[model samples]
Target: MDKKAKALELYLEGFKVVEIAKELGVSQPAVTKMLKQFPEYHQEKERRKKENQEKARQWRNEYKKQKREQYDEDYELVLKSHREDAAALSRRGKLSDDILIKLCILNYDYNKEKERLVFNESAGKRPADLPRSVYVHKNVLKQFRIPTRQ
Candidate 1:
């Protein structure tokens, strides 16, 4: 068959423009120009684009679902540790309902903060709301004999 026919076939079979160009031993623009001659070319390309977008959307949704499951598992582990700490405090006669509620809040806050930090770090961006350095009084560090950041 002719180059146009072969190019059309490859394009309909979902081959990339560059691949079709290589197969036909022609430049990419030439292959594109040839494909443009056909009425169905743009239609097929748009269909493929939409199909790829749908696939990407599904992948992102699955990734978010997995992350949610992992978050749940991690939160459960944190709660278990908090419960153990509360039990220990109770054994020492220091646990209170108010303190237990505070522990749960702390656990929730810690997990959320940790998730935010991890996401920011992975995305190669710093959290805009977080300070780069904490402001600690020099006198307190000196009293504790702890090294201070300049």
Candidate 2:
């Protein structure tokens, strides 16, 4: 590389401009002019940045593809196992239909509680004065439901 380019790279690599000028044994203004006059360094920097971005994009795509493949394989295995377990439980008569229904109800309740926790956390400090009936949906609509007395 040219002395000017080498000096410029050194300066860009964190050496002070004055130090680079002193090392190159050129006047400070001369070094500055040399750096400014060369467009190759700027082009190289832009090219490196673009290359890094492309590499990052490729890495992300590969990661997403691998994750999706693993997810599908795990999903298939889980669904297969779940169906097999449900069938075995059914044939064994281990769970009364009533107990199974209660288990399902418990699961639904757990999920609702978890979702409510996330919703509340995202909403920050909820105003105590806000009505209990209000809800925000994925479609960006506000829903207000009135409670019916049993």
lDDT top scorer:
1
RMSD of every prediction: 16.4, 16.9
In candidate 2, which residue ranges exceed 4 Å CA deviation?
5-36, 89-150
Report the lDDT tens digits of candidate 1 across residue range 1-150: 999999999999989999999998999999999999998899998999999999999999999999999999999999999998878687658655344434332222112222221222443454443332233333432332334489
- Report the error of model 2 at residue 70, Å: 1.8
State how far residue 43 of model 2 sits from its true place (Å). Answer: 1.4
- The count of residue-pair clashes in candidate 1 stands at 0
lDDT of 2 by residue, 1-150 (tens): 888778768866766568988898888888777777668556655677798899999999999999999999999999999997787578766754433433333222112322221213343543343322222333332122233489
CA error at residue 124 for candidate 1, angstroms = 42
In model 1, the runs with Cα more than 4 Å from the true position are 95-150
Top-TM-score candidate index: 1
